[model samples]
Structure formats: C-alpha cells, structure tokens
Target: MSIFGKFHVPSSAFALHETLTAVPEMAIEIERVVVTDEVLTPYFWISGVSPSAFETAARDDQTIQQIKKLDEFADSALYRAEWTAQVQSVLYAYTEIEAVILEATGTDQRWELRIRFDDRDQLGAFQDYCERHRIAFSLQQLTQLSQPKTGGQYGLTPKQQEALVAAWEAGYFETPKEAALTDVADELGITQQSLSKRLQRANQALIGNTLVVSAEYAAPDAPDPDLKH
Candidate 1:
C-alpha cells in the first residue's frame, strides 16, 4: 500500500525562491504543477502582490530559467515557469504526487508539500535525489492510506475541507435550501463564484476518492466505471 507523506522543501530548492527573494511580501499558492513539453509548468495563485510589483519581480528574477504570466484575476494571478534540470529530475523521479501546497507567508520562505508513494523504496529514492542535488528538504508528516484513494480526509486541501464542512452544516445541499452559496461565501469572506468553485472541486475530490472506490467494489460488470471525466 502507498504511504502518504508530507515533506518540506526549503525556499532554496524552488525556482520561485528567487522571485520570492526579490519580493518578500508576495505569496503564492500552487493550484497545479504539471509537466508539459518537457518543462514543469507550475500554475500558482499569487496574493499580496500588485500586478505591477509581480511583473517587476518576475522580470528581475534570473534564477528561474524562464517564467511567463498565464492568467490574472482580481487579487490573484497565475504564473508558469521552468525550473533547473536538477529540480526537474526530482519531480520525474517520483511516479505519483498526492498533493503539494505552499505553506508560510510574509517573509517566511518554505514550501510544505504532501506526496504519496508506493513504498519506502520510492521515498528513499526521492530523498537520495534531493541529497545528490543538495536540495534542503525534510519529511514533515506520514500516514498510511487504507486503500488506493482512501487517504485520511480523502486528501482534501484545507480550504476544500473547511468549505465542504461549511457547506454541509449550512445545508447548502438541502432541497429547501437552508443556506445559499452567497451566505457561505459571505461567511468565508470569499466571492460567491470562488465558493462555488471550491465546493465543486472539493466534491470532485471526495467523490473520486470515496465513491469511486465504493462503486469499483460494488460493480458487477467487468470494469464498470462510475466516475465521469
């Protein structure tokens, strides 16, 4: 069974470190990190930055091989960039990453990442990779998944979990509508659209982890799939 583990990689190991170093006040939350066209494109939602300052910081930062703004919205913007070959090697070395979230803000430079692996061998290989490259990293948390896709809380992001709980308690899923999205959004100090998106994403993750397993076990037909992509 795969074990769930949370690890911390110091700021020096991330390509964004240089940008963060340049703009100490800026903070980023990773929405996704994907490998495309032989490059790692990390989509981040940046906060505590004005568009002008963000642009200036990214432009001035040279540690990252390349960077480009992908999209922008009110109070948040998305960015994509490529890391060095040594950084790329660590990501490719691991077959699966359960989750990766940016932790710390306001001059505290560090990234708390949660990842999953098949066994100790895989985790050890990654540690060796980090050591060989001299990347400062440490394991923070570890837990055993009950089954594939059955990790505690189904691996929901903290925001997702909190939003899910609020949604349930507020009766957002009720037929009579005991509460509305706007109410939850107001309480959470987020926009309605943001609340909706968070709830939807949370639902998807929960369904993927819990219901998918239930259906797979209950299905009578050969390889019956309950999930829709």
Candidate 2:
C-alpha cells in the first residue's frame, strides 16, 4: 500500500477571481480545486513577462466579447488554465518539476489550492508557504484501498467488494428500482457475466451466514496495472 497525503492551502491570490469578473456570460463558482505538486519547487517563474500581463489579461474589458467566444471554443480551457497555474506555482516554486496532482477551487477572495506529493519535503515547503502567507492549511493522510484490513471480515476479493458497492449505488435493492445491471457492468468495465458472478459471491460472503468472521482480510494484490490507462 502507498501512503498518500492531501494538503488544503488557502491563498488570497486575486489573479483568478479577477479573471472571472471580466466575463459576465461565464458564471463559475469554484466547488473545489484538486492538484498534485509531487516534484514542484517553491518559486514560480513567468517568462520575462511583466506581472501586469496576468492582471491585465484578467481585468481587460475589451476582451469581454472575445471571452464569451472562448467559452464556446474552449469550454474547459479556462478551468485548465486555473488548474495549471495553481499546480505549477507550488510545483515550480524555484524550478520546473513534475507534479503528482494539483487542484484549485473557491471563488472571490477565498481560494483553496491542494497539492499532493510522495516526498515529504515538497509538502513541507507548501506548508511553510501557507504559514508565511497566512493561508489556512490542513493535511490528511490517504489510506491505500489495496491494504488487507479494508475487507473487514467478509474475506471478499476487492473486485467482488467493488461490484457489491456498485450494486448498492445502482439501487439494485431499491424499491422503485435504480440502475440496471448493464449500467453497473458498464461502469466497472466488466462483462455482465463477470459482474453477476462477483456480486453473487460478495452477497453470499457478506450476508449468507449467521456467524460472521471478525477478522478483516487484506488485498491479495495491488491495483490492476491496466487501470493506469
């Protein structure tokens, strides 16, 4: 199992907020920002360009109509811009670096940026920046789902467990009926034949017997290698 960390850092960076106000047609309230700064430095460097470029690009009024066009042409481009900068800032603090994940969210004067890293030092630098900037920050450790203990006493394979979860979500047991078997199968990317087999196994293991096993089983193996795609 891999140990992962989550950091929530608040920044008063007005650059993003100012950009939103320029386009009246586009109304976006940030629900959250997700980012990975696995290998980023602490300093951000813009190509010999003046800081005003950022300020001007966001506050420019003449681009209002053009910005509306952008919404049509590049729906997710603005969001991508926001995500890239927020991630790059922490990752490229002093130099170019690869990031694990970088996410940003919020609106107006309050924005939360999250960065994740495998190494502790990168996370430390981000924490330091948050303290120096008076940004509220939090750290959460992500437990690996592949770990053995998560199975709890059922001794079900992870795939079987996941299929059972999908059944519940699909409302297979619901009164009015919910998601179909094919729906769940499609979501899991498995043949209906496979999904059914796993779901049945999970049910029998979890609910069939009166006496339940108290011991939790760990994963037999790590995640599938093909899932990276």
Candidate 3:
C-alpha cells in the first residue's frame, strides 16, 4: 500500500533558497525532475516575477549550476534548473529513497511537498534519513492510499477535499457568491492563490473521476459508410 505525505520545509533548508529569498513573492511549482550522473535537473513553473529578475537571482545562487527559461507567459514562466552536485538537501534524500514526487511548490517562507512512498516502511525510512542529515521538515499530513471508495469524496487528497468542502459551504459556487475569495482563503489558513489552485485541482479531479470515462469504456463511434474501397 502506498502512502502520501505532505511536508513543509523552510526555504533556507531547500534548493533555490537565495533566489526565493531575493524574490520573496515568487511562487514555484516543480513540474518534473531528472537525476543523472549525480546531477539533478528540475523543470518548474515560476510566477510573481519577471524572467530577467528571476534569472539574475538564480545566477547568483551557489546551489544552481545553470538556469534556463523554457517558456514564458504573462504571469508565469517555465524554467529548467540544474543543481550543483555539492548541494545535498531533501531532494537528494527523495531520490535516494526512490519516492515519487506528486507535487512540489515553494515560496520564500517555506516549501510544500507532496510525496508518495511505497509503503509505511518507506515513509519511515525517509523520515529517518531527514533526521540523520538534520534536514528539518514538518509533516503536514499523511494518508494511506487505500482501495477507492464510491462515496461523496471521489479521489481528492485530504487538503483538496477540505478546500472544496470549505468553498462549497462558504457559498463560493453560489450564483450570488456569499463569500469572497480572500475570505475563503483566510478561513483555510492559506494564500488566495494557493486556495484557488487547490480548488481548481479538486474540481478537475471530481469531474475526471465522475463525468469523464476512459476511451475503452466509452461507446464506439459509428462505422463510416463512405464509398471508399
């Protein structure tokens, strides 16, 4: 049985510490990571700062070997970063245990990471490893991925479920809208942007699980009757 864990690590203890500190409002969402030849390369999305500003800050960070902007949008940009080999942090620990990173987001204040471990033992080992290396992390939530239940909660993680329920109860989905986005975010003890992201993911999961069907399960298309031999 796999287990999902959410943790919070202070920015000072994680990668991109300098860059995030310089751009305090910047938010990062790691898209994927690749480790090869003892070097870790991560592709991530960055928001709240211009590409030049982010690049300048990243260039000065000792932990980063190189940074490249892959794509840019009005408010956010995608970047790839190669971490220096000498920099060992929680990310290295994750790769050591072969844990799957479900979601990883960071800010100047802290980093929120959701990781999936093979089982209870794997999760325990990860915790132990962090302790041995004095890598400080606060465990936010731990959930066992059990058999799916056909209930009101489809396949949402605990945080997502909480956000969705809170939003609904706050009348966020009502025609008149009883509560403001800030109000809901404050109630959930998170930033408005974080709340919005969570709600979006929750809605997507709900629709995908309930309304959408796999291609194999969907009805087959009618055969074409065109006169082509």
Q: Specify the highest-TM-score model's number.
A: 1
Local accuracy of candidate 3 as per-residue lDDT tens digits, 1-229 = 8788999988877788899999887777774566666567777777777888888888889878678877676666777778775456545555678786656788888888888788898888888877888888999999887766522245455567778789889998999999998999899777777677667757766776679854222111111111011
Residue pairs with backbone overlap in model 1: none
Ranking by lDDT: 3, 1, 2
Query: lDDT value for candidate 3?
Result: 0.71
Candidate number that wins on TM-score, 1 or 3: 1
**Angstrom error at residue 1, model 3:** 0.8
Give Cα-based local distance difference scores for all models: 0.59, 0.42, 0.71
**223 in model 1: Cα distance from truth in Å?**
37
Per model, state how many residue pairs clash. Answer: 0, 22, 0
lDDT by residue for model 1 (175-229), tens: 9989999999888877677677667667776777677764222100010011011
Task: List candidate 2 segments past 4 Å from native.
Answer: 1-8, 20-88, 91-97, 132-229
Give the C-alpha miss distance for residue 181 in model 3, angstroms.
15
As a TM-score, model 1 comes out at 0.65
Q: Could you report the Cα RMSD, in angstroms, for every candidate shown? A: 9.7, 15.4, 12.1
As a TM-score, model 3 comes out at 0.64
